[model samples]
Target: MTQVAELPASAAEARDHVHALMATCPRPCGEDALTDALLIISELVTNAERHGGGMTGFRARVTEDHFDVTVEDASPAHPTLPGERPAGSVGGYGWHLVRRLATSVAVTPTARGKSIHVGLRLR
Candidate 1:
């Protein structure tokens, strides 16, 4: 699958887009992989919305073995994984979780803002 579009800053809207993409994805994805993908997508979108000052663009690509997701936001501040939080911390988990789940992740800073790219291997 290959598609790109602008997404609202809202997590709910981002989730809706993820679900629709999954439904029509070119290859059948295992439930577990899809769930993981959803979680990663949610966190990325949420981070873009909450920390990046709102999402400006979203793109997703799925292949037989992996999926790639990219999110662009309006803030130039690059995202960073917070230092180890105390156990049971209430927040600061999004970037960490993305790093844990994705096979590879990258953040690119642009003149206008930044973009996050995550690649997850299918189960």
Candidate 2:
């Protein structure tokens, strides 16, 4: 397993990290996985920056069937659905989209903050 450990300054930076990893790593499924992986990374990093008080760490790795992305942030809050608000809300789309696209999602609280792990299956 090859893992890239990088704490990007922004979502763009995080995407660049993953993009570089894709160049060196073999694609288990294809381009679609790349697209999904990028989108997931973007959402995770962006959410951390906007709502979680900025991202603290980032890691991405590819296994035989899984492309996993882990992001750590300053906030300890777990992601929630937008439906908690009114029907028409601007927030929560990122969390919802991430859960919909990711094969697995996890939240772990740390001493400084929390880490969110999201995985996409390459099948």
Candidate 3:
């Protein structure tokens, strides 16, 4: 199934929406993949709110083999991860985690902003 939500000021709101989407999945989603998906949603939405100048849209698509997520924000700046996270650093870790959790990630620059597309394996 597919689900979409307007990007909200609060990351928690976005997180809840993603959870609702996952709950509607036609097939059973494993705990590990589900957890990873939720964390990815939280990180992307939070990043959009904090650095992308707020989120514009969010979407998710689920299939037998994989789940896809796309997040849009108001800034044209694409997200990037550091070569390596410094030990003991608390922040600036979201993008790195997202990369590791997602099987594939793409950044597309839009007219007014950018969209981050992430694909996660379901199995």
Candidate 4:
């Protein structure tokens, strides 16, 4: 399994970790997939810190067909799609982007928080 000894403190660190791992994976994802994966990582981590209390853990791994990332945060609330708002909304698009880019997304609840697992198909 692809693993990290120390959990990353921020989205950049998490993306760096995944980028390095992708280099070693037998089937690396495409450039567009890489960009999408990074954005997914960033949105999830930022959401954890900004809305879900704070991030508690993070992990990224590559399988034969998918690049997977999981972000754990200190909240039980499941993420929701952005509801109707002003015509020119500044934010709340992150979750939607994640859902669109990821091949699959799952949320698991824990005693203290929740973990969001997002997977992107590899080329």
Candidate whose lDDT is highest? 2
Question: 9-115, model 3: which lDDT tens digit per residue?
Answer: 57787667767777777788888988999899899988998889888888777776688889998999877666555666558878989999999999999887999
Better of 3 and 4 by TM-score: 4
Give the lDDT of residue 65 in candidate 1: 73
lDDT, candidate 2, 7-88, per-residue tens: 8888898898887776666644588888999999999999999989888888898776688999999998887788776887
Off by over 4 Å in 3: 84-90
Instruction: State the weakest 10-residue window (summed lDDT) of model 1.
Output: 1-10
Clashing pairs in model 1? Answer: none
Candidate 1 lDDT score relative to the true structure: 0.80
Distance from true location, Cα of 39 in model 1, Å: 0.8
Backbone clashes in model 1: 0
How do the residues 27-115 of candidate 1 rate in per-residue lDDT, one tens digit apiece?
Answer: 77789888888899889888887778888888887766787899998998876656765666567878888899899998899777998
Please give the lDDT score at residue 105 for candidate 2: 94
Q: How well does each candidate superpose onto the true structure, as a TM-score?
A: 0.84, 0.90, 0.85, 0.88
lDDT of each: 0.80, 0.86, 0.83, 0.84
> Ten consecutive residues with minimal summed lDDT in candidate 2?
20-29
In model 3, state the lDDT of residue 17.
Answer: 74
User: What digit string (tens of lDDT, one per residue) describes model 4 on residues 1-123?
Assistant: 565535788878878887787777676668887888788989999999988999988878877667888899999988767685466666888899999999999999988899999888977
